[model samples]
Target chain A: MKSNLELLTIETIAEGFRNEDFKPSEVMEAFLENIKVKSELNAYIDTYEDDAVSKAAEFDKLFKEGREDLPILSGIPISLKDIFLVKDKICTCGSKMLSNYVSNYDSTVKKRLDDQGVIILGKTNMDEFAMGSSTETSYFGPTLNPWDHERVPGGSSGGSAASVAGRLAVASIGTDTGGSIRQPASFCGIVGLKPTYGRVSRYGMVAFSSSLDQAGPLTHNVRDSAILLDTLSGFDNRDTTSLKLAPTKCYEALKKNDFSPSEFKIGIPYDLLREGLDSEIDQSFNLLVAQLEKMGFKIIDVSLPSSKYAVAIYYIIAPSEASSNLSRYDGIRYGFNEESTPETLEEFYVKNRSAGFGEEVKRRIMLGTYALSSGYYDAYYLKAIKVKRMMQKDFNEAFKKVDCILTPTSPELPFKLGEKKDNPLSMYLSDILTIPANLAELPSISIPFSISSSNLPIGLQLTSNKLCEDTLLKVSSILEREVGFKSKT
Target chain B: MVEKKEVLKISKLSRLLIEENKIDSFLKNFSEIIEYINLLDQADTTEIGKDEEIVEYSFRDDSEIEKLEVEDVVKNSAKVENNFFAVTKVIDEE
Candidate 1:
């Protein structure tokens, strides 16, 4: 088995497959070998060794027959965050609740990826229900950051990000509710994109906060992300919210769009830069801005005054939505249930839920329930909705003036495992800058910036208007090139 | 300040049982989180008057589609009987 296939990106792997440099099964084995060697990273929940290998063989045979219908991602090995259901496979959303549960049908994401002829390695671990900032809350365990074993890979999409960064898989897909994909992508020294809401269908992707949840790409570079997003995005009747727009435009634009850096005006919301940002991150971000300016890109200061309340708005709205969505996990229908007898329906539900969920998930559920409860609903849930409108208004105003907005993907570098485990507020606050974009339903991507003095990677974030992933990927790829930052090899 | 009893109440509503030992810490964390999010109170939404809720529904013809088999629907249940979910008794035996 060749060793370099695991490190080859989706784009490079596609080129290799086109050139018949190596068989797809060889690529699958290389990734499988890497997964076995890096098992301690705990990136993968399970590896479909036989299934993935067989699928790669089928693709290889198709290649031999001179098939003209092969997509750009044909034979590329990738991983999915466990939340996206793969039919006939277990879809454990990083929670004990669905540990034994098998998916009955393919999530739209899985169906789309399957159509692309991509070889799926397996499902990756995540924060339980994609709830935590780090993968620590996963029932399987925290996915250790490959850059530094002691540190965390920022999560609920930590495993997806880590798989790409650690080269355990060629590229992966992760969901970003509130920085789940981007933050992990930043921490793992890779590119992660959270596309505009409704850009991709959510059917089969488990709901956390229904409105805030959208799936996108986690990859080694911006082009790969565009390619994956192109494959994953489209309208589906199964997902009513999925946009009825032309699909597969992102990768084409990435290949053909020629808007020079000088034509782009990137905004920096200096006001939203909280006081406690790590000084090193501040220096690196400033350097990045200077580099963009040097490249003839116009950098402007835009104000998003309401973004300061983003954390507060996200906590209330996400949890309130979560409380309702999660109610489907009643013990009678599906998910984990007690083996022992409970006399009443209420007792059965409480017994299963209390035992099924991890700490952070329960906390969010309770917080959501408290907010949406009778008297408090107006003060908490309604109030947050009003504030969310303000946040969205701010983004609307900003986007009118600038093509895109720039911010630090994370306030700090990847922290040590167990660092913020007990501090839920701090963990929630970690998402401050990222939440505003989610609130506005805009497209955002995190690109690797530079390594800190401690050798951990940091990422710079770019946000574009809703449904503007084309420009988002354009700006990101430009920055990805300008910086020329390489991940730890 | 959020009280312990309020936390318990929220847990009851959420269908989650907080253990006796974990309630103290759970309550502590819950209170702190609530306090932190209270920052939203500072944002003046006075001008943001009652935004009338508007929901736009996209209409499509209601046509028959393939549906999950009964066994497929109930396969993930902890207990399935008669091709349906089996649950604890909902009625009392007087």
Candidate 2:
């Protein structure tokens, strides 16, 4: 029963507290203990042990007193990708530069979660500054995939994904900049949502690519993603990109259960399936299509012509923005400072950044700076933006004929840690299928579909039009129930 | 292929110091990535003008508030002096 309680969903945990079956403190203890047991996975950068226990205790008191003012996610233990700022807490952003940096203010997402009374288990790990496709670039070390201990939990939201898959927490928050959340979620065999780009605020999220970065949830299943989204998303004056639109009513839409596969037009982009797709993944995907056909959804062949160039586009734009965003990390204001005095300020800047950042982070920063450099700006940054426009056009055109598009979350299964560490480009390819969704600024979710012959999990990606996360969630929940792919971790 | 001199220039421009020994490996990786991104040259974007707005952002009111205390602002600084961040001196007196 204790084990069962550890894996309970947000809804179940809330109901359990309401019924007086268990208190929020028990849930916190269970997760905290599980987190300790899974420490070797390197899934968390730090855990909020005292803060979480105290929060849970306070919530339990409210529950015991029969307070009607309790928030929806009150007492649920959730992990945060170290990228989100929690006031007075260390937000390393999985990089050594800001290893000791503490945030003075809460990110909109963190503040929202706090308001809802969600117990933060800790800050999960990720790629350094959300640059890489794998968590290997993290200064804290790579987060190992819980499913296969030898393989990586996909990143840059890898630790968040692993935490949910390992049942360390009910659900966790992760940011997706070119598929950081979804790709890792796919690798770890869990539900990861990358909400519409502006649907969630990015006020205190350390900027990777300002245009592409979005914060969303990673969970064991779909409903929790919706519940987290319902609470985490809203307008924030702090983030200019934050949507001024009304609440998406994501949780309420899930309860409606008013979905028909027959009525919704699902598009299959044959372009994604043709090249570099693993045979086993292709077979599993075909089987899924057959199941959807039997369920009455019309699968139309749609083409995202410019999607083939998505990785190239993402690499250019993300790095260019990163080069600019990370320029603020010079040694003076905050972060790692070099002890040796330099004759010039420029020397201090160069030396501090060189010593502070990891290899991959430096590579991208250089790449971005080069792309945004005078001579190459037209060839790289400008060209990538044009391609981005075309990619967005491709998705918009596809959506005209179909309600949503279906694709594999990753082209291949989760690979062994250090497999692609030496070859950075090969590592970047893992996010090929997931990158287009971010490039288009669309809502996408990765739901576990099957376990591979080697016992690794593979996920199916569903992307809907911008702000159509409700449609994406409804279809994903239906498929989640139908597939019922039990997570073995 | 990028030359070592070019790599040095780019690294200096980026304000990131690449170690002298690692320049060769950095050049190889940088060139390969550049070659990969050159595929964008094949895309015909003549119809899409630079004036075409890709994203529209909503602005917020410019109300200023005392959000962070001076202590919190300088909390993470390597050196703080009188509520101000202490940095290496940039100007030298004649």
TM-score of each: 0.98, 0.98
CAPRI level of candidate 2: medium
- In model 2 chain A, which range of ten residues has the least summed lDDT? A1-10
lDDT, candidate 2, A418-440, per-residue tens: 99877888888788999999988
Scoring only the A-chain of each prediction against the true A-chain gives TM-scores of: 0.98, 0.98
List candidate 1 segments past 4 Å from native. Answer: A1-3, B52-59
Clashes of each: 0, 0
Taking all chains together, the TM-score of candidate 1 against the true structure is: 0.98
**lDDT (10s digit) by residue, model 2, range B1-94:** 8778887887898789888788778888888888888888889999887868645788866788447788888988888899998877999998
**How much is the lDDT of residue A147 in candidate 2?**
85
Q: Give the native contact fraction of candidate 1.
A: 0.77
| The 10-residue segment with the lowest total lDDT in model 2 chain B | B60-69
TM match of model 2 to true structure: 0.98
| Local error of candidate 2 at residue A428 (angstroms) | 1.0
